[model samples]
Every structure is written in structure tokens, then in C-alpha cells.
Target: MQLPVEIPGLLNYWIVIVLMMVGFFVVISHGNLVKKIVGLNVFQVSVFVLYITMSKIDGGAAPILDDAIKNYSNPLPHVLILTAIVVGVATTALGLALIVRIRDAYGTIEDDEITNQERDDA
Candidate 1:
């Protein structure tokens, strides 16, 4: 049967939505610090994919001065994504380091357990 809209054209968007939801679910449903970090990374990746997908152009060429190249895709999105990747890596490293410190101090990485310990201490 013919569908209402073209599926192939929007397939990338569907994938991005699915990935975004999965990442969000993982972050919301899990209590483990590492798991949360993983979820965040998944979410970050989905966003990166979204940006890249949106920046794509049909029959587009690199931004270069050429008379034959009438259509030139914007390079800003790619550059921004590259910067974001570096920032994401640094942020992940910092997050993991903080988690390590939290584990050492609380003796657990689970959020509920840490809260319980704090409650008991207080």
C-alpha cells in the first residue's frame, strides 16, 4: 500500500528520533553514573547525526571558488560538529573523573545508594 508520505526521504530523521528517545530513556531510567554518562554520549551522537543530516545538500560541492560549482554546501555545520566532538570528549573525560571521585567518596556509583548514604550520615 502506498504510504501517506515518503519514508525513504525521512528515514534519517526517524533514526535520529529513535536514537534520541533511547538515549533519553536510558538517562532517565538508570541510576548508575556510568550508565548515565553512556546515555549522554548516545544523546550527543544523535544530535551530531541530526546536524550532519540537516546540513547535507544534493549535488552540492565543497565551499570553493569555482565557476562550475553552482551549489555549495555550507561548511559551518561540519566545523561546528568537529568542535562539538572535541568538547564532548573533554566533557566525557571530566564527567568520568568526577564519577571516579564520587565513587571513592561514597563507595558506590548508584544515585539511590549515594543519597541513602548521605541521609544516613546526616
Candidate 2:
């Protein structure tokens, strides 16, 4: 029986999954706050790739309506992704701001060290 995610046709999906796993690993395993943010961005990029891949239709043209073009790729996904990109930028900025604050307060961005310091203080 043929699986839905065959290796030949779904290489992009496989790549995305691998990227997600790498990102997830970095986020979970790394103690540095900056590394976690980089991992999160990687994960976000993989999701964006998945969405774009899913929205693509074979032989589909841009969403311009024309008599000659039968298949038109859905623009909604692209639009939503654009909004997500904006939100992602804002979120990243906020995260950086928080990181700066955390660094100022704790003098370190490593999660383990910060927690250890907190424990010593408290």
C-alpha cells in the first residue's frame, strides 16, 4: 500500500518535518534564551513552508482571474502568512526586549544559570 507521504513527491514536507524537529530540539535542549528564540524562528519558518506547500496546486497560476487559466492558487493562505509574518516580527521584537530585561536583571541569558541564581537569592 502506498502511503500518503511518499518520499518521491513529498520531499519538501519531509524537509519541513526535519526542520521542525531540529528547532524543537534546540528549543528544548538548549539553555540559552537566544538559542531558544532562534529555534522558534526556525520552527516558524518550517510552518510557513508547510502552509505554502499545501496551498500550491499543480498547474495553478496566480489568483488572477482569467478565462485561459483554470486553476488558481488560493490567495488566502498567502494573505494569512503575510499577517503572520508581521505578527512574528512584532513577537520577535517583544522577545528581544524581554531578553534584554532578563539579562539586565539576572546578568545572564542562560536558563539554568538564571534559575540557579534565583534559587541562591531566594
Candidate 3:
């Protein structure tokens, strides 16, 4: 049950996964709120890229229910990804707004400093 070109496909998937993991790790490991936001954006964009890549066939055209084009792809994935992208934008916006609040409240944008400030205040 061996495939002739397993390495190529696996290599692509591996790169995608590695990029995703790296983005997430950067988001979590960053202490600056803005950096975290950038990381999250990277993470989200990576997922979007992966999704769009997966949605494409060897030579499939855009999915439109029209009589002119018969080799159309399934539009569900693209639609779902559009929704996900909207949600991700909203999430990123919320996170940035929270960062603004955090900056105003703590006078700093570093996560550790904010936590320390809160502790000192308490």
C-alpha cells in the first residue's frame, strides 16, 4: 500500500504544520501584546493559506453554480473559510482592543509587566 510520491505531499503538509506551530508558539511566547497580536495574525493567515490550498484541485476553477463552467470546485470550503476569516478578524480586533485597555490600565504593553502591576496593586 505504498504510494509513488508520498514524500512530496507529506513535505507540503509538514511545512504547513510547522508554520502553524511556529506561529502559535510565537503568539504564546511573546510578552509584548502587539507582538502577540502579530503572531496571532500570522497563525490565522497560515491556516487560511492551508485551507485555500487544500480547497484547490489539480485544475479546478472557482465554484460558481453557472452553466458555463462545469469543472467547478466545491464552494463549501471556501465559504466556510470566508466565515472563519471574518471570525478571525473579529477575534484579532478584540485582542487588539483588549491590548489597548491593558496598555491604558497598566501603562505598559508587556504581559509580564501587566501581571506584575496587577499583583503590586493588589
Summed backbone clashes in each candidate are: 0, 0, 0
- Taking every candidate in turn, the Cα RMSD to the unseen true structure, in Å, is 5.0, 5.1, 5.3
lDDT of 2 by residue, 25-63 (tens): 998999999899888888888888788888877666888
lDDT of each: 0.88, 0.86, 0.80
TM-score of each: 0.84, 0.87, 0.79
The lDDT leader among the candidates is: 1
TM-score of 2: 0.87
- Choose 1 or 2, whichever is better by TM-score: 2
Candidate 1: tens digits of C-alpha lDDT, residues 7-90: 476788999999999998998999999999999889898988888878867666888899988887788899999999998899
The CA-based lDDT of model 3 is what? 0.80
What is the lDDT for 47 in model 2? 83
* Top-down lDDT ranking: 1, 2, 3
Tell me the spans in candidate 3 whose CA falls farther than 4 Å from its real position.
1-12, 65-70
TM-score of structure candidate 3: 0.79
When summed lDDT is taken over every stretch of 10 residues in candidate 2, the lowest stretch is 1-10
